[model samples]
Target: MTVVMVEEIDPSSADAGVPAHFGDPVKEQRLLETAVGLVDRSNRDVLAVPGDERASWLHTLTTQHLSGISADQGSELLVLSPHGHVEQHAFVTDDGTTAWLDTEPGAGAGLLKYLEMMRFFTRVEPRDATSEIAVLSLVGPAAAELLPELAEPRIGAVPGPKFAAGSVPPEATAIYSVRPFEGGLARRVPLGVDLLVPRAAKTSVIEKLGVPRAGLSAYEAIRVAARVPRLGHETDHKTLPAEADFMAAAVHLDKGCYRGQETVARVHHLGRPPRRLVLLHLDGIATDHPPAQGTPVELDGRAVGFVGTGVRHHELGMIALAVLKRNVADDARLTVGESTAAIDV
Candidate 1:
């Protein structure tokens, strides 16, 4: 089990009010627009599943079609409860003997626990390998340029399940490619060997490559814009996969049976989803004040649903993603907590 906590980088120290997790928001904003930026996501968890039956075991469990996943390809999988709520979202990459599951920052424990419990009947071995592997996200338009300079197997836009492997400067192995997101581009590099580069070298890498450092706040904004439903934000044990937009990205309709497959198939075939995920544009000055999750979303004196994630956009005003009743009108004027917002559909 490898676990490492990264030192926080103070955003205020930078002129752009960037948070510590993301070095400089100003630079990050620039990188988002023009160049690429590196975000150290080492805090996320990486689970390693190794064994002869790893592929079949995972195939029988998760949502994606794991049988077709080759050694060089990767797929996003959603682990859901029998009730159809998301338990964990993972990026699974196979290297024949081992399958690496990269999960969000706080989801490692739960995923590992579930994997362990399920392993009783299978030959798969699940190990927490987050610390042993570091995740560096290179985002924005110029990310493709930086990948070729790093290692062999040039980065290319391969459809589902394909990734490129390469070597980084100072002897580091990197997996660089654009992962599937709602609407934007994201380049991920998982460091294979620990180089233990000095802080100066890391800074130089960022500067020379023109990769901006991002924080959680910037990530939040980017996620909202991309309409990517995160585990904590748009998903829960009470929420179904159909309501969280996972059906469009992670869920497979014709794949072999897996846990929660019945509910997903039934919902999609019937088109009877209880709720729909919709984006909202708040109708007031942007502020840090956001409606609490599960706060009622009222439309025309009727209860619709509730807010999921809310953010104050620099230009787009206050925008949010909400789970509302399927019957709610797209143009409905809704009240999120005490704030008023229009449904962006």
Candidate 2:
């Protein structure tokens, strides 16, 4: 589906070779919200931590607790700089033996280095699995109901009100049909299922799934609407995950002793984050495109922050996720480049 979608894209509709949408972003988003929509996220990367103690070892290194994570259960984790700035984001799952870490494209190597560097006497062996794995997504009201067709190999889950993606593979879909794919619970995007399919079978699997295809544009629009921050987009090297509202999905304040935990604790217990994530309603009537990401966001003629992902949605028109000084008021009117925007309520 990805190969087919990208081949015939309008020159203005793509970025990094992925189409923003297949000409009708509005329809695509509506499908994602109402029917089933498939998205190509093979651009992501994965690492396999196969060892007898992979879970417990990762427990000490990352923000998510993994000491006794059950098979197919999953959670999101953050690898922060010692200063508590966000460095890496991993969607983690354990299939009883090996723990799989899925992350954004080009991030597996750094995460693998971190994992390997911390392995002193622990029996963990980490390897980049990008050559063998790819990620795709199914989202919408019908997403779970269609799991029966793609249930051969699956991955784990994510946390929720308590800071972990809530559904495990078996429970995410009551199908146990022996499909061997890795997955993580999408914490920010509701009712979404990510499939870590074997690279060798990707084309075939996509061809077999009978759903309308959504481009990266539709996906980004919905993500922005949900206010989920994508790593490397909403975060800079100095970003605190807390500033992007990652605490509800990635951070576990009670799990002490992890790297960067002290800083997280201090900030969580004593001080407010210096920055915060906000949803922006872009001026769609005046401009077809929202300001480019990383565009300076201004308020009262002063640069306050930067924009993240911006997209045109079927229901919401133009919207973007942005990071701003914590002092910015919720009702503040801001500007991204020359485009006017307001903090979404």
- List TM-scores for all candidates, in order: 0.75, 0.85
The runs of at least 3 residues in candidate 1 whose Cα sits more than 4 Å from the true structure, single-residue gaps closed, are 1-27, 148-210, 286-288
Residue-by-residue lDDT tens digits, candidate 1, 1-345: 121113333222211322334434444555554665555544567888988888778877887656545555455778888866778888766655778787777789999998898887788889988666545466565655654433322222212222122211111011233332222123343311111122334445446545446654555555676677877767656788778877644666656577788887777767668998888887765444656556778987778887777765555667788888988888777887667888774
Error of 2 at 155 (Å): 17
lDDT of 2: 0.73
Question: Candidate 2 residues 1-345, lDDT tens each?
Answer: 223354354443323444556767788888888888988877778899999988788878987666767674666789998899999997875666777788987788889998889999999899998788777788776776765443333323223323433232213211122234433322212447777677787778778876778887778777888888888889887899779877766766666588788888777765578999898888876678766768889998999999888777787877888999999998888888768889976
Error of 1 at 5 (Å): 12
TM-score of 2: 0.85
How far residue 45's Cα lies from its native spot in candidate 1, in Å, is: 1.7
Where does the lowest 10-residue lDDT sum fall in candidate 1? 165-174
Which one is best on lDDT?
2
Q: What is the C-alpha local distance difference test score of each model?
A: 0.61, 0.73
* Model 2: residues with Cα > 4 Å off, grouped in runs: 1-19, 148-191
